[model samples]
Target: MFRAIRLPRRTLLTTAAAGVVISSGLDREKLPIYPTPNPPILLVDSPSSLEQQIGVARRTVVGTYDNAYSKVQDVVSNWIGVEKAVENRIKSLHDPTEPLTPSLLYVGVATLSSTIFTRTRSLPTRFLLPPTFLVLSLNYFLPKTSTNISTYLTSLEETYLPSVAEKHAIGRAHTAMTWERIKDFTQESREKFGEGVRDAVKNVEGWTGLKLGETLRVQKSEAVEVVVGVTKKVEEKVEEAVAKSFVEEKTAVDKPKEVPVKRLV
Candidate 1:
């Protein structure tokens, strides 16, 4: 019967590191588009403005020193765990803890191991060499690989996230400003409309010579009739002047002008 061995969280993290390295080699344009982090409402306005806030949050959330230390710790711990797993896998091949049956497969493996032992003069090289080589190789390469992954991820965040965050923040601010402007305009319009209505009411009251709740009784004022008669008389005088000018022009045109005759001398 086989029992399951639960892998540590560090193992999972190391596996993820491998994935990240693989992904970094691929075309970045083909990567998924992700949205930026949004803080609570009204906290941010633009990217430049939010930089200070982000810094404060970073320091306060976990102290600067602590955060950095934890990162280094995680990297070291993960590498150690990964190297240990590699050692175990290698060790299992040569010296497995499980019982071995006398089957053809076992016989062949044993025969191969004995032959390798004879060929290699070094006793440690016969059994422990492969695991030691693997541990050393992983120790050297994993740090570099993981560091590259971290750098790529950091660059991605810097390139894409800040712009998105700024746009979102500015968009929100603009929306709020627009709403305020609209409300102010609406209020001003209502005030002006009310004033116009009041003025109209006053003008109507004065024109009709009536008060509020009064019947529609239009008084025939002789002043208006007199003004209209005066305007009509003025118009007639202007028309007569125009007609007289035209008549004088026609008479002047009909009158023959004496032409000077040049004598050929």
Candidate 2:
């Protein structure tokens, strides 16, 4: 009798427990991976994979920069013929083929002209700052400045670097602007994108619109061709988040491998 009663009770307990689990609507096997409500597409533990992790990018900053680079190259290449023309006059009077010929001066002048074109390509246009800014920023926002000799090198940027304050000021301003531009990536994702970002981006778009951020793409609907023209010094962790930000329907910015820099002659 006792055995029969105990067996029935145990069976009942087991059934009740199973029912409770289902009633609670809990899936023991599944748990949310991202803490943030709007997380990036891919999460990389290592920095090397950041570039590889770039998700289904709807747009890329490199495109605009790349176009700029190509345009500048064409301009410089055209000047090469001018240099040859200048040399032609000298070639007529002397053996221009000779290395020591006076035509060498013409060659030098042409070379210098091309160098200027390169310089123009290097500088930030109305659209953006050149890669030099990123190099400077990486040096500026050092995770540990005094850790190595590089620290001293970056420190020198503060002293010898031209327009340090100017660049930083522009950088900070651009950063403020970018936060807002990012918000527009996800419709109704405004809250998910964050707070200060919305205001900053809205203001930036109001001031610069799509014209400034015209790195990867351009649209007529946008007030300007570019968006917030920012060059941030993204750390390793941040890079991972950014890389995975793309989705099939939703879009995000594509980080470029090389940042542009413009220096004086």
Candidate 3:
């Protein structure tokens, strides 16, 4: 009983250390890592890895999805001057009869930013698709709430952070992918993304507080777009792999067992 509580604390310290180490390996190409402290719930690094260790793959997919999201921020930031315009244009495109409201614009940018960035970074797209589908289904079926605070707060977060993240994604991906395209952009990105990375590192303090039972200033509720997005993604992947294995097993069973080959006389 005494050791159980201490185990989690020790694991957190060890995981945080591991995060720092793994993050260090990720160059600016994968900079601004979101550190997590749960060593026990480890995430998989790639699809091949997931195939190897199905359990760990579930966790790793979430981490990889996080990597995908960090890039989403980069894409949005790059859209700065153009993001607003892009957001506005898409909103109008979606609504032919009605005038685009600020609210509509907000959702538009969030969806568009995520969509476009996902195209460039298909890992997250393939990863995010099922989750987005689930959340949209949830919103459609369960959106009604009896309370006002929940509604108002949800509205507010949906507006601000997605806009912010979209803009950030644009900027950072421009740097990372640009450098990825032509190494010349590497120096350019280090200078530009430096502030973004620095700010990202600084933002960790607030989220860490949430884990410790402190309130997140930004109403992590909106960030549910991120949380649910990521969670749904990882869950779907694990489920898919499991389903695939079961299908394979069933296929083998349905077919006649192979007869042992006899050696030729």
Candidate 4:
């Protein structure tokens, strides 16, 4: 019955890669085990799992510290790009007699703030500082000098302290902006993977005539258990192999070597 339902190959691969490949048609005991691919798909059964996967993803994408620093630079560059775009649009209006208004500056700032700050929250505070500096520079609120920026921020240190700023460098406005963007991104992602999950569940539901949600919950549990069991076995095998190799080496080193004695007679 499960074989009858066809899912998009890409979607199936995605679900499988997430370590949630649901298979109600086959017995759990009979499932064939195989080595997970290099850079194994994370089974995010809990919040900790999700956090672990996200950290791995950040390290992979950001690469070296220099690269991460460059990414922050790029964020500033993008803000400059927006500024250029806004300036060009204003010039296109071709009113030489008109002054370049704060209205244009406001538009540029809005675009910059939305795009720059809306980037994933996983980015480190240090990385955000570069773009934050650029925002202040472009807005003419502050000179983009490293020292001045540092000094100004230090003055605001009291705000960042436990007494005021909290652990993050965010303010009420930033909190609002970040949450808005996070909501939008989360909703979009949910609708995406949710469709795939729902479709898979529906296929099983058709076979068993069970409700979609209940079938999904069952499949999710089964998949998590299968993935965890497989992972544990793999880890155990690796540890055993390492221990055996160490023992063999130690024995080889400790064994007495037969040396031929030269008889003086």
Best by lDDT: 4
Per-residue lDDT tens digits for candidate 3, residues 1-265, read 4654455778899999999988878864564568757668778866575477976877899999999999999888877859788677544334344333554454455556666656766686757864575445434333442123244554565587778666666887889987677776777788879777656655775666433223443566668778998999999999999999999999998999779999999
Q: Which runs in model 4 stand beyond 4 Å of their true positions?
A: 1-214
Residue pairs clashing in model 4 are 159-165
The Cα local distance difference test for each model comes to 0.69, 0.56, 0.66, 0.71
Model 4, C-alpha of 113: deviation from truth (Å) = 22
Candidate 2 has its poorest 10 consecutive residues by lDDT at 138-147
Instruction: Please give the lDDT score at residue 89 for candidate 2.
Output: 43
TM-score of each candidate structure, all chains considered together: 0.21, 0.16, 0.17, 0.28
Error of 1 at 137 (Å): 60
Whole-structure CA lDDT of model 1: 0.69
> Which lDDT tens digits does candidate 1 get at residues 1-265?
9999999999999999999988887866475688757876766556675898898898786787898999999999999999999777544433232333433344455546555655656775656655454444433434443344445555665678977666766887999999999999999999999788767767988898667323322233456677899999999999999999999999999999989999999
**Best candidate per TM-score, number?**
4
Candidate 1 ranges with C-alpha deviation above 4 Å: 1-160, 213-265
In candidate 3, stretches whose alpha carbon ends up further than 4 angstroms from where it belongs are 1-221, 260-265
Model 4 residue 254 CA deviation in Å: 2.5
Q: Per-residue CA lDDT of candidate 4, range 1-265, in tens?
A: 3667778899988987666445543457574588756886888665688899999989887688778799999999999999999788545533454344653465467657655665765557546655665565544532233344454465577655655544444575688899999999999999989898888878878898879787558899999999999999999999999999999999999999999999998
As a whole number from 0 to 100, the lDDT of residue 133 in candidate 1 is: 44
**Over all chains combined, what TM-score does candidate 4 have?**
0.28
What RMSD does model 2 have?
Answer: 45.6
TM-score of 2: 0.16
